[model samples]
Target: VQILDETGKILVDSGVQKQYVDVTNTQGSWVVTTPLVANQKVQVRVKVSDGSLWSEWSEPGWMKYELPEKRASLVVGEKNSTYVKADGTLWMWGDNEFGQAGLGTTGGKSSMAMKIANLENVIGVAVGSNHTLALTQDGRVWSWGYGYYGQLGDKNRTYSTYPTPEKVPNLDSVVAVTAVGDYSMALKKDGTVWRWGGSSSGVEPQKLNFTGISAMAQGNPRNAGIVLKSDGIVLDFQGKQVPGLDGVVAISQGDGFSVALRKDGTVWTWGGNSYGQLGDGTTTNREKPGMVKGLDEVEAISVGEYHVIAMKKDGSVWVWGNNRDGQLGDGTKTNKLSPVQLAGIDAARIATGKSHSMVLKKDGTAWSWGKNESAQLGNGTTVNQLNPMEVQFSSK
Candidate 1:
């Protein structure tokens, strides 16, 4: 076994360290200890020798190592938090009144992060008001929590709670998913969209006519959905267009509005603005998408019931809109119609809930602020954190 940097420099040579000394069992796998000497892309190849015969070197597997700042995906529900680590482990915490936490029981609340029992290989996750949706690396979708209204997509008409993951029936090869309100949406690999649960329609998985869809976001009501197409067009699930938006790289939907990040590092927002979730420096609602005032180099965005959060390309975080519960993480509860930057931390990604905010730092740490009546902060207490509080995950 050998590990080499992108430039072909040897980083680790198992032959020199005799790491593969167990040569008696050819059927067993070999293990080696290697230290990464630099933060960069590396490739590894393995060779097996059985006494007299030496096997050819295996195909190289390339991987990137950005230690301490590895990537992570996070989602904050109305009263819970969910995160997926770089290693594909899924975790959840906070309110579980309806088994939304998916721990197999309807526990009141969990102040510490709990690993979803037996859930692995997760590539993405979305937490709705009272349910969750997870996408595995193999393109399967699993859901749990509130199954009422058929949001779980298992085809059971009865309304109830599930505390464990259930495979979404008749759905496969799903690339992305979002659980919002009493409904859920999935984007297939074929660029088509599917909808299920209670919305303007009934509880069932119905295929949308739109194709070339890349991503999806849920707007205020369960019926409202924003779709991002592969051709850079942004449209609503009802087939209405998001005016003034193009070259969009990402999209996020809130209570009644939606936000989109353009390829040129700017943000465009529209829909309801009663609490200024639009971030356009006004409380006026917009019928068409427009640029969010004074923000650029934006990388990602998340919207809550009436608030919004954005992560800039520089890793800095900014917030706007409703702050009655201090979800803004800006050390105050005053509402802002414009964006306000949070100091002292740079985040890799962010997620917004009904009245709380969650961020995954570049260094792989989780933090939260705002409504903590149910201890969503995962910091061992129910006290609300006006600013960021590091969330402690239970040891696996």
Candidate 2:
């Protein structure tokens, strides 16, 4: 097999200058380790031999380079779900009562994902109770939906709802955005924090005094903000360091609790554990961070109103906490005090809504389970799913 640049020059693997590399019949694919320039166009052609005469080169297949930020992503709100395809087109469905689906109407609910014609080049999306925020490749933010609490960040405090996307004023260079409850928060490229919405900040975004923040997560219902610093320390919304928590690489917040993933692959939890969402084997609220029971080598995590979903390095998913609606995807309504492995799928990404859960599988397909009263599962039905079911989109 050989890889050629746009000009037809053969690309050699690193540490060797050979124009092509031979592969065994057993090898189904190969990786081109040579560094590629941004936006570089390339093509590949393959040939096979049966230990005799060599076959002619196959047709060249074109490949287009895309930045890492251009990859697809999924996010869920209280009762709605949104997805941005790799091509930068956005799609959404479920509860549109408040127009959170960004479909320009609030009367009908969509069970299958519908494309949002107004949004393009969306790199990331964040959803709150009834509001949605989209971050574009240019580092600008767009908002819509319930605006009574000013969560829209569009500087229209009097407007109760925005059925269409509106550019959030005064925010630029935003690397990330998170929303929950009645407000929203943004992290800038400069490591600064900006907040708007709710009664605290009004309609315009206010720059918080906090700095050096590497990432941020906000708790649902509680609206508590947690930020991770480059120095590996975690701080709460008050800018106070979380007790006994350090070396944290990622953070997520739920109803009244917080979760942190350490660099060592262990999970930690603190705060309200009324339903054992903390995975500590006891419904005890932790004022300080403590290691979650029976979990390790965790690669990623997502927290819902009263549940937690974790993915291991091997792609296995585990969940614990309030499972009254089967959000845990364990095929039962039983709430687990400790992490329980979710069988049947290998997850590439996971998201949790108020009472539902979603998983983007390694094969690029999406699945969902749990409460579907509002059709948030995107399965074309309103039946509650106790196990994972493939989400059906209206169109590709």
Instruction: Indicate which candidate wins on lDDT.
Output: 2
Cα shift from native, residue 196, model 2 (Å):
0.8
RMSD of each: 9.1, 12.6
Which ten residues in a row are the worst by lDDT in model 2? 12-21
Clash number for every model? 1, 0
TM-score, model 2 to reference: 0.82
Shift in Å, residue 255, candidate 2:
1.1
Q: Pick the candidate with the highest TM-score.
A: 2
- Model 1 regions more than 4 Å off: 1-70, 199-203
Candidate 1 local lDDT, 336-373, one digit each (tens): 89998999878888999889999999888999999999
TM-score of 1: 0.81
RMSD of 1: 9.1
Off by over 4 Å in 2: 1-37, 40-66, 221-223
Inter-residue clash pairs, candidate 2: none
